[model samples]
Target: MAPPVEPDALPSPFAGLPGALWLYRFDAAGRAHVLDATQCGIDAVHAPDHWHWLHLDLSDARSAQVAAKLPLPDDARATLLSPDSHVNLQLDEDEAVHGAFVDWAHQRGVDLAVEGQLRGDDGIGWLHFALTPDLLVTARRQALRSVEAARRAVGAGTRADSPVRMLELIAGRFADTVERSGDGLSVRLDRIEDRVLADSIGEERRDLAQLRHQTVRLHRPLTAMRRVLKQFEQRHPAYPEHELLPAVARLNQRFDDLDGDVATLQERARLLQDEVAAKLAERTNRHLYVLSMVTALLLPPSLVAGLFGMNLPGLPFAHSTHGLAFALLLGVASSVVVYLALRRMGVSRST
Candidate 1:
C-alpha cells in the first residue's frame, strides 16, 4: 500500500485542481484498496480482476487514488500522474484512458460528469461509484451539509453493507438537500403570494422575479441528477452477482421520487408567476379606470372656468350676482351627468 498523506500535507502535486475531490477505494470486504496506475507501486495494487468501491471528497486527492484504481487504458495511466485542470480532461491526454473511463461509465450506465460546476447554486451533485467485481468511485465538488453528515456516518462505520448502501446514504443527503430547499421555497412562495394579493406592484414584481430566478437556479442540478439516476438504472457493470442489483434498483427509485418532487416545485413556481401577473394586470386596470374618471370629471369644469375667466364684456353669467353659485351648480350638475353616463356605460369605481 502507498503511504498515507497527512490531512495537512501542504498541497500534493494534485493541489489547486478545480473541482478537486478526495477518492477512497474499498474492496468487497469494505476495506480500502488502490486503483491502477503505471506509476511505480500504483500498478501493483490493482491487479487483473479486483473490484473496489470509492468514496471521494470533491476537493481532494480522493479522486486521484480512485483513478489509479481503475483498469485504465494506457492513456489514462499516463495522465494519472500528469496534473491537469479537469478530471475529464485526463482522457484527452490519452485516448485509451478516455475510452476506458468512458466505456466503463457507459457500461455501468452512469451519466457521470467528472468536472464542471453543477450550476453553482444547487450545491454540488454527488454519486457513489461502485463496480461489482471491479471498482466503485463516489464524487462531489464541495462539502455539502448533508454530504458531510453522511460522510460522518460512513466514517463511524455505521452499516454500509456495500457500495450500494453508501450510494443510498449519498442519495439520502441529496434528498434532504432537496427537502430543505423545498421548505425554503415554500416560505418564499407564500410571502410572494401575499404580496401579489396585497396589490403592491413594486414588491410583487420583485418577489416574482426573484422566485423565477431561484426556481430556475435550483432546478438545474436536480434535473441533472435525475438523468444520472436514470443512466445508472439502465447500465449493468460487473459486480457481485448476488445482491447489488436490488440495491441499485432501489436507489434508482429514490432518484425517480426526487425527480417528481422537483417537477412539482417547478409547477408551483409557474402557477405563482401566472397569479402574480394576473394580479398586477388587475391593479393596472384599476389605476387606469381611476385616472379616466378624474379626467372625465375635470373636462367640463375646466371648459366652463376657461370660458368665464375670459375678460370679454358680455361673457355669459359674468354680471350675475349668482354667477359663482350658478357656476358651482353647473359644475355639480355636469359632474352628476358625467357620473351617470359612466355608470350607464358600465364603468366601475376604481379607487
Candidate 2:
C-alpha cells in the first residue's frame, strides 16, 4: 500500500481559501504567474487577455463550495465535481471541454512499482478538469503524478497559449504514463509467453489468466477513450487555423497507438492461455490413458483371485494342497496374457 498524499505536498497558494491548492494566471503574452486564490472570486476582475488556472483539492471539505464560485456552465461545474472514476470527456453545448482522465497516482513514502512491474490499483489515479476559452480548473481527490509533471514543465518555461493547451500538456503527460505502463505490461507478457512455450502449463494457467485480465483492463478503457475522441472529432470537423482540431488529433493518435499496443498484448496473452490449456489437456489425457492400461492389466488377475477365494462347494480346490499353487499359477498366467494382449493393442494415440 502507498501512503496518502500529504497536505503540504502541493504548495497552497490560497492560504485562507479552503480547498484551493494552487492557482496561476497567464498574461496576454502567455507568461504564467502564480496567483492567490482570491483571484478566483466570481466578481474578480482581470485584463481582457488574462486567463487563470485554479487547481482544487477535492479531499478538502469546502472544495464543492469553492467550485460553485467559478463562472462556468452548470454541466462543466458538474463534470469538475463528478466522482466518476472512468475515463471520460465531453464537449458540451456551450463548447466547454470537461472530462476525467486516468493517471498514475503520486505516492509519497513508498514506491510500489518495482522496475518493470506494475502494482495494479496502487498506481491508478484520476484527474478531473474543466476547460473553457480562458479559465482552466483541475481538481483531484488524490495526488496525481501528472500534476507534478505539469508543474515541472511550467517551471521549465513551457508556455501554454490557452487553457486547452494546458489541458493538452497535462493529458500528454498521462499518455506518457500509459505508454510506460504498456511497455511494462509487454515485458511481463513476453516472459509469460516464454514460460508457456518452455514448460508444463498445468501450474501456470492461473497466472496466465491473470495476465490476460490485466491486459484487458488496459485495453477496455483505452478503447472507450478512443471512441470518445472520435465522437468529438465527428461533432467538430477540422478546418484551417484550429487549435483544438490538431490537439484532439494528436491526443487521439497517442491514445490510439497505446490502444493498439494493449490490444496486441491482449491477443498474445489469450493465445498463450489457449496454448497452456491445450498442453494441460494433453497431459491429463496421457495420465488417463496410463490409468486405463493399468486397470486393464489388473482386471484378469483380480477375476482369478476372486474365483479362487470363493466360498462355494466346489471341493476340487479344497481337497489338494497343490490347488493353492495351481490357483496362484493360474492368476499369474492370466495376468501375463492380458498384459501381452494390451501390448499388442498398443498405447499409440493421436494428440
Candidate 3:
C-alpha cells in the first residue's frame, strides 16, 4: 500500500495552506510564465492586454480568504465557494462563464497504491472554474488529473492566450484521462473474456463488478459534462467564431464515445457473470445426476438382499444348504438387470 500523505510533508508549493495555488501569465507572444500567487496583485489580473490563469485548492481554510479577495462575479464566486456544486456550466449575469467538471483524483499508477490503499473521493473529484475574457480561475477540493495535466502543460511553456482556450485545454485533458481509462478497462475485459472462455473464473466476478462500478461513476460525470458543453457552445460569450468552440464540440463527442464504450464493457461483464453462474449450475447438476444414477443401479440389489434375509419360514431356498450362494447369485443378477435397464433407457447418459 502507498504511504499516507503526511500533513507536514507536502511539497513547497502546497506547504502551509489548506490547498495549493498556482498562477500563470501569458505574454503578447503567447508564452507562459509561472508566477507566485503571493506576488501577483489584483491590477495584474485586471490589465486589459494580459491573460492569467489561477488555480486554487479549496480544501484549505485559507483558500476561502484568498478567493474572497478576487474580483469574481457573484455567481462565479458562489460556484468556487460552494461545497455542494455539481458538474455543470453556466453564464453569469456579467457574461462570465462558470462550470464544474469531474476528474479522477487518485488515478491508478499515478498516486494510487497497488494494494488498494489511499482511497480518493470514491475515485473521482470535482473541479470548478470561472472564466472571463482575460482571466480563468479554477478551484478544487482534491487533486485532479486534468488539473495536473494543465499545470504540466503550462509548465512546459504551452500557451493559453485566452480564458476560453484555457478551458478548452483543460477539457481536452479530461477527455484524454477518460480515453486512457477506457483503454485500460478494455485490457481488463479482454483478460476477463479469456478467463470466461477457459471456464477458469474464480474471483473475476468481483473484479468485473468493480470495473463496472468505476465505469458507471465515470460515465455520470462525462454525461453531465457533455450536456454542459452543449449549453456552453450555444451560449458562450467569447468570440462566436472561436476555434476552441469546434474543438470543444469534438471533445464532447469523444466523451460520448467513451461513455458508450464503458457501457458496453459493463454489459459484457454482466453477461460473463451470468455465463459463469450457468456453468457452475450445470456442473453441480451433472454431479447430482451421476449420484442419482448410482443410487438407481443399486436399488434392485438392495431390495433383493433385504427380502431374502427376512425370517419367514416359507421363503424360497431359506432351508436349502446352498441358500447363501443362491441368495448371493440372485442379488448379483438383480443388480445386472437394473444396470442394463438403466443403460437401455439412456438414464446413465450424461446430459
Candidate 4:
C-alpha cells in the first residue's frame, strides 16, 4: 500500500481556506463516479491532466504561489519560472497590477476580468473568465469564502468535463462573491443607518472615500470580466470534445446576476455618499445659524458698552449707579429677544 500523503502535499491549493477538487468519471448518462481531490484517490496528485478541472482562490498570493510548484512540461519550463510569471511582467512602480494582468492576458489570448469593491468597512470581489484552452486561472487578493467553496466543489468532482464547465465554475464564483459582498454591505449599511439616526456619529467622509476607492478598484476587474463573458456568450468555443452551450447559457445568467448585484451596490454606495453630503450641509448650516445668533446677541451689549465708554462728560449712562443696572438689563433683554427670535425660526443656537 502507498504511504499516506500529508495535508500540505494535497493537489488542491490553499487547503486551509476550505478548498476542494473533484474529478468526474464519464459514462453514457454523463459524469459517473466523482472523485474528491482532497481525499486520497487513485487519480489525485500525479494523475493525468483531464479537461475542465478547476482550481482557484480569492487569496491569490497563496494559491498562485503554490501553482508555481506544479511540475511543468520541459517545453514550458523557461516560461513558468521566469520573473514575469511571479510578478506581472508589464507592471512597474507606477503601474497597477490589474492593468498588467490585462495586458498579459491580451497577449496570451486568455480572456479575463476582475471586480473589486469596498462598501464601508467591507471588501467585495468579483472575478471572471481567467481560463483559456490551455489553462484557466483567477485570483482575488482578499480572503473570500466563496472561492474556497467553489474549489471544494471542483475538488469533489462535481464539475463537468469541458472548458465551459471551468467557465461556469468561475462565473459561479463571481456570483458567490457578489452575494457575499451584498451581505457584508447590508450589515455595514445597517450599522451606519443606526449611527446616523440614533447616536451623534461623526462624519463618515473618510469612510466614504475609502469605499469609493475600493469600488473603483473592483470595477476595473468586473468590467474586464464582463467583456470576456460577452465573448464566451457569443463565440462559443469548442474544446474537451463536449457541448458548451448549456454551460455558456448558465454562465450568462450568472453574469447577469453578478452585474445586477454590482450595480445595486454602486447605487447604494452613491446613496450613502449623498446622504453624507446632505448631513454635512445640514451641519454647516446649523453652525452658521448659531454663529449668527451669537453675533446678534453680542451686538446689543457691545453697542451699550461702546456708548457709555465714550469719555464725553454728557454720555447718557456714565455717572449713575442706576444707569449701569439699567444698561445691564437692556443687554439681558436684548439677548432674550434674539434667543426667542432664533428659537421661533427653528435655529438650535442655544448653548
The runs of at least 3 residues in candidate 4 whose Cα sits more than 4 Å from the true structure, single-residue gaps closed, are: 1-151, 156-159, 194-203, 236-242, 332-351
lDDT of 1 at 288: 87
The alpha-carbon lDDT assigned to residue 247 of candidate 3 equals: 63
Ranking by lDDT: 2, 3, 1, 4
**Stronger candidate by lDDT (2 vs 4):** 2
Write down the lDDT of every candidate, Cα atoms only: 0.52, 0.76, 0.75, 0.49
For model 2, residues 1-48, the per-residue Cα lDDT tens digits are 998888646454443446877777788777788766644454342447
Mark the 10 consecutive residues where model 2 has the least summed lDDT.
110-119
Write one digit per residue (lDDT tens) for candidate 1, span 1-351: 989987655354542222223334454555443332223233343544344333345455445654554565545344443433221311122212121011001112222222112222333333323233343344444344444555555556654545445555655655555555556767777777677667654666666576667666656655655564455445544432535446546756765766576567678778877887887688788888888889998888888787778888987688889899898888878888888988887774554
Which residue pairs in candidate 3 have backbone atoms (N, alpha carbon, C) closer than 3 angstroms, thus clashing?
A: 18-60
Estimate candidate 4's alpha-carbon lDDT, on a 0 to 1 scale.
0.49
Task: Give lDDT: candidate 2, residue 274.
Answer: 84
Going through the candidates in the order shown, the clash numbers are 25, 0, 1, 18
- What C-alpha lDDT, on a 0 to 100 scale, does residue 290 get in candidate 4? 71
Candidate 3 off by > 4 Å: 1-20, 107-122, 234-239, 242-244, 304-332, 344-346
lDDT of 3 by residue, 1-351 (tens): 999998545544423323437887887666788776776654557665788888888877777765665778878888877876567777655668777877767453563212222232446788888887788889988777777777778778888777878888888877776776777877888898898899887888788788777777767877888787777777775745655567667877887887788788778878877887898898899999988987886788789889987888799987799988988888889878888888899987888
Q: Which stretches of candidate 1 lie over 4 Å from their true place?
A: 1-147, 191-202, 235-244, 348-351
lDDT of 3 at 349: 80
